[model samples]
Target chain A: MLTSCTNAIILTVNGDEHMLVVEPNELLINVLRNELGLTGSKYGCGTGQCGACTVLIDGEPALACVTLAVACDGKEIVTIEGIARPDGGLHPIQEEFLGENAVQCGFCTPGMILMAGDLLKRNPHPTEPEIRHHIKGNICRCTGYNGIVRAIQHAAARMAEPAAADGPDLVKEAR
Target chain B: MKLESYVRPAGLEEALAVLAAPGPKALVFAGGTDLVPMMRKMRMNGTLLNGDSPRVILDLSKLDELCGIRKAGGMLEIGAATTMGVIAADPSVKKLVPVLAAAAASVGSPLVRNRATLGGNLVTASPSADTAPALLAAGAVVRLAGAEGGPRELPLSEFFVAYRKTALQPGEIVTHVLVPLAGRPVAGRFEKVGLRNADAISVVCAACEIELEGSTCRAARIGLGAVAAVPVRALAVEAALLGREITADVAAECARLVHEHISPIDDVRASAQYRGWVAEAVVARMITDTAREAGA
Candidate 1:
């Protein structure tokens, strides 16, 4: 009975390990927001298609709203809150987004920024079409996307500059 | 989101062992893209039968067994857990099975593709699914596995028995999809009409695979989605184009047959008449593009 009653979910968010006891009906988004106090992620549609709930699972951007909390045991997870360094320095993507003026009232900004970060991590210098293609699932109700596109392009340049210097060796394999 | 029980196994063997036990206690998971939304559906019919409080939540994330792509004998072998983003960007699939890549690239968005798996799409078995029509045209096959036995396979066309239905047994899960590789020498295209674009379900869609040999119509296969209860092949058009000379007249003939072959109904996204017209127009356009790609 002791072995049979084992229940544990291990999560490592932004290199931080978290152990949780989750309800069978709990979602990753709800757990992150309600339990762990990481509420930077938004819940727009409660559906997977909307990128509002996007988070990185095993270093890959995933929809957290639809993800079951129990499914993330001993796996790496990342949310909008984790994008910044502990010293209060912003990630290159965050700096680029602010510099390029990609935020507007910014309800969708958290998801947008994280999704862009995920895309740049995978492809440092994505084409215009590729940039659009990558963010297609993350919708923006305000600022009508000019700023988002600009932000993505700006981040891509910064990301690609490093990769260009180090070449393919600098490129981390996508999970 | 609250769950009663959650189980994460290091791999498939461990996960399957926990799932094999008999109880209303468990539900298996993947991208969670579709399942999470279904739980919150406002008007969508049929919720996941696992109930609100499953005793077992088996997380299969550690199973690397169901990821990646392979090519052999002119067939594209796609792992069940292979993300749509990976498939869309894979150069091999782009060059050989471009239709699949095109369909993959068109799915939801980059974030979705980063997590959405091809196996998840086919397993969900929505009649309007974007990739289904493309895979159907490519002569795709489905491979499945269970706790007890060896892997088994089935034709992708037959995998969808009906609307919101599948041929998968309760204990089994899909493992992969095999689609024939069509080189540049051939012609094919996929077109879908959705509510808006980017993450909308198809109101109507069509896919065609064709070949042109020396100005003569060598062969063709057509697949339609959301125009019926299950995605159906355009046998009428396929029959009409076989051995026929490439011409505007041939496209018109194929378009005519396309109308007769499909049975679309009025739904929230579109009317039956609009679906019929779009089906015809899409068939004609696909033929035009395919023949043009053939360089004649």
Candidate 2:
């Protein structure tokens, strides 16, 4: 019979590489939150339904709550913390979320922001329905999601025109 | 959940050897979307804790043999480990088997679909599996490899033995799903009635693939899900529509015959009566939509 054995895995998170020993059953959410001190990914429903524990695994959004850490060896992961600019500034999506009052309790903010970032990356100009469709996995109990949808639209507009002085003001028009 | 060991075999041969081992309960792990949640549930119920023997997880994500979509002869052979995201986005799948692509797209959200695999969806054997109905309607075949046998293929219709049970043997693992491509153009549609638009389990789902010459149905295959012990092909409905002209009345009559093939039970998602009603509605809509797409 196979016995319990700890496996050493290397995870590159937010462009930093770290080697850690994890159990076979250790989930990626626990490894990121508890072991690596990156708690941006929240553990909502341990099941795959709620996307609160979302993170980018190899450039694709995946639920970390159900992902085994050992299964992610040598994979590049980006968390909510990594969504910020390299210069320590908030991303456009984050800026729009704050500017649009998209956040209420902030429990689902990290996941929502990460999902928006992924959406904007894939589609620079997404319609309102596309934004809603892309972030369907994430659930926010506080905000009815109108603000979230508007914030994503504002971010898309801002990202499309980086040099425009009226980029941040697009949220007002969106509202 | 406590796992004794996890092994990511380097190749298919090594994976089969590990599965053939006499000791330890080995579970095939792919995508980990279903298995991880299932293990967590078992842990919550104290089932895994009470078990005396160790459990081994055989991870197949790294096996190259089980991870691609290719065309071989007349078949579109899709690797079992191919993710739903890939399947939904693949050009060949979208162009060839559109119903499968639509079904794959209607699975969980982008995050879930990125990690959830085609094999995991079918192997989990859930009655409401989004991809099962499309695959069954497409007349797909499952290829299995075991320690003893060289390799074997089974029709998707025969793969499911019972509720949450498959025909997989002790040492067998699903390697690929081969979908026979039709020589002629076929119109297909997949409909899934979930509680919400996204990330909701299906109350009733149906897939229809119809070959039409003008308004006459040359051939038809109908698969239904979430309204049976396992995903089932609506054989009676297919037979009824074989040579009939696909009109609204014909579609409605064929839909009414779907109840004879499905035995849905009341669960948290829906009641059996609701499923029956929804099944008829969805089946009728799918048939009508597919026939219309076929220019019937």
Among the numbered candidates, top TM-score falls to 2
TM-score of chain B of 1: 0.89
Write down the RMSD of candidate 1 (Cα, Å). 5.4
Q: Against the true structure, what is each candidate's TM-score?
A: 0.86, 0.94
Backbone clashes under 3 angstroms, per model: 13, 0
DockQ of each: 0.42, 0.53
Task: Please write out the lDDT profile of model 2 over residues B1-296, one tens digit for every residue.
Answer: 35678888888988899889988667788888888887886666634432423478889876799998999979999999999999999999998899999999999888888878999898888889999999988989999999896899999999988988889888899999999985533689999998889898999988989998878998899999999999999999999998899998899998899999999899988899999999999899889989999999
Q: Score residue B173 of candidate 2 by CA lDDT.
A: 90
Please write out the lDDT profile of model 1 over residues A125-173, one tens digit for every residue: 7888877767777888884588788878876776667655334333222
lDDT (Cα atoms) of all candidates against the true structure: 0.75, 0.87
Off by over 4 Å in 1: A1-6, A99-101, A126-128, A155-175, B1-4, B7-21, B40-55, B72-74, B147-150, B181-185
Per model, the share of native interface contacts recovered reads 0.70, 0.66
Q: Which 10-residue window in model 1 chain A sums to the lowest lDDT?
A: A166-175
* Model 1 TM-score relative to the real fold: 0.86
